[model samples]
Target: MQNDIIKCGLTEQTDSQFVDSIEKEAYVWYEKNWKHDDYEHSHHRSQLTFVEEGYQYFHIDQKIYLVPQNHIIWIPSGKLHKITSEAQTVNLMVFLFKSVFKDDFYRDLQVFAVSAVLKEMLLYASKWSQSVTEDEEQDIFFKAILKSLPNFCKESNFLEIPVPKDERLIPVCHYINVNFKYNLDIDSLAEKGKMSVRSLQRIFKNETGITLQKYHQLIRILKSIELIDTKQYTLSQIAYLVGYQSLSAFTSSYFSIMKSKPKINKK
Candidate 1:
């Protein structure tokens, strides 16, 4: 694979007595600069990608998911997806063999909130030596991680920008992605897509699984999230930049989408 990050693989072998067992393996990547995989690919093993710093954008299931710092994206085995990293991103991806998780429990791609404990555990797991044996102390730690996986896993309520397969909708999706800061309405978007307002609404709902207004709202909130920690911009400025006319309305909408208040650390 063509990547800008440095990657390493760690493997654990089992003794002959455990012939039925699958070997435990992990591939760790530390990304520094921005990069992207424009093509889709799938892995035989399940993947847990953790964002330690910075953020990443993932294209999966015809939707765009913005994975910010401290979040985890759980990709099931054989799930086709692509990823683009933001500048100075440092992330780790743990590739687990099929036997690591039951099929029913991890059959789809998901985003999860990472607790402090889970973060530490993932860090520790990434450091396991290649000579790791089945009975080592790390083995017990790995087992504990496996036991805790189900409890830690959850579906994130983050903003998802669904991309429709229809070619006509491509221009509309692109417009929302690039010009989210501008005033946009269904009628204007319909005109841009060269379709009637009702046809645009129907096609957008059918293709993206979200109404046009909600999708626009999601993009605005997502943009605010990206700008929250910039320090150069005040909360009010950030809100206005993302198309919200009122700070109160922006805060309310932000809290609704992010499930938390926006933290500002201006200098």
Candidate 2:
């Protein structure tokens, strides 16, 4: 049965608010549930998700990302993806439309390693949510959070997953990067890696803190984002190119993993 606790769609703004002298609307939500569910597709808005507590996973194409505390996920506009989390997960999510920030400054989604100052900013924003009167202060805090994002062009090893030094999983990992668009499963991947499925599962989790399927999903989603960002393809076309047959199916799966849709820039 499909999980229904987590709802998906565009976030609504009850009122227009400006942050950091930037006139952009925002949506903040706090949820507790067994899982977060959403459809796969692209959107016109960029998003930032902060995981304060509990375990969550993001499937970006074929690579599975383990989201724990003190980490943020940035989803650029028009990138199709989805997100799921275990029960009792608390998150601070920020959404921004393209028209809000300056072109050069806020052109993409960036995952920033949380800093002490940024943490405090999130705390303040949460508190401010209880009182609408703190608009100015809230705006300041939100702007600071946006400014803290690591620019996409900036090279930072911190933004990457730590591929364990395990020699066994190396081939599996390499194969994933090379063949993410192909239909693959743990059993096939294990055979390709020359290991038993159970052994591969245990080793992968032990090394990457995520299962083999999840790892592949993350890589696939990330690659999908890259294609959307670099090439000109319709959402439907992208879905098939990435191994999804039905556009609706692809969109649903994508949203379930990326938490936001792929951003497509107009030519």
Candidate 3:
């Protein structure tokens, strides 16, 4: 139930030092069992998160994203976010200041599929705490990994949910993002979107592939994850922030969706 904060600096001879030796390099791989008391606030850093085991909900801006094994979450520098994991899971994380990578490489925040090569590279980087002599090799390998990242523009249509092109749905989705804390339902959302309930439901389902209620749940859960990952607020505080009437209700819904209780750790 303790909140642990480990800052990796270049001058420090800790596990993060191997990463620190490389200009703009920051990487850490560790296992931890996090409890309800562990909450974190968002801070500025370009980060890449890869989960080798378990499931997690990641919240960024007002969107909730489901992350599973071999799936990576990339946080742009300065973007606010949090994470909530299903259990004690093995996760590999790389943090960079963005200035380290070439300018064009760091343009957007995205989650990409991890290839076998990238996975092995992560494994090597995780072992950095064990060897300082591998600093040169690690630096070269890290750059190669970054260079191998697929450009978004080239494969923009891959696995990403495109924002609706419809103008009517735009304002509705925007309102939902801004007011997720409110009890928003089809009727209320329809009224706000200036459409009939039936039409709203149809359009929303077509655009997002889920019902309105389910979508809202997804959004709420994602937000909760962000709050947890960043250590920004307590579980009770996050529960209320996402519009749950009770902590138990929030916990139940979270477990139902993620298939496990909220816990964070290295697998």
Task: Write down the TM-score of every candidate.
Answer: 0.80, 0.46, 0.52
Residue-level lDDT of model 3, residues 1-267, one tens digit each, is: 222333433232222221244433544543334231122334445666666654465655444566655667766665655566654443545445434465655767666656777777777677664233436676676666666665422332122323565678878877777778888767777887799999999987887676777766766776676566655577788899999998898999788665556543321
Global lDDT of each candidate: 0.68, 0.58, 0.60
- The lDDT of model 2 is 0.58
Q: How many residue pairs clash in each candidate?
A: 0, 38, 13
Model 1, position 80, has a per-residue lDDT of: 72
Model 3 ranges with Cα > 4 A deviation: 1-24, 32-40, 88-90, 103-105, 130-134, 151-195, 198-267
Model 2, 134-226: lDDT tens digits are 366656666666665554223222233547567877788888889888877777778866899988888888877766676666666556655
Residue 239 lDDT in model 2?
80
Better of 2 and 3 by lDDT: 3
> Could you give the candidate ranking by lDDT, starting with the highest?
1, 3, 2
Model 3, position 246, has a per-residue lDDT of 88
Instruction: Write down the worst ten-residue block by lDDT for model 1.
Output: 11-20
Report the poorest 10 consecutive residues by lDDT, candidate 3.
Answer: 10-19
* By TM-score: ranked, best first: 1, 3, 2
- lDDT per residue for candidate 1 within 1-267, as digits (tens), equals 323222223222222011113354433344334355555656466667777666677898888887776788877766777776543434444435444655466676777668889988877766653332454666667667766777887757554668789998888978987988877777778888999999999999998888877888898887776786455678999989998898998999888877777776443
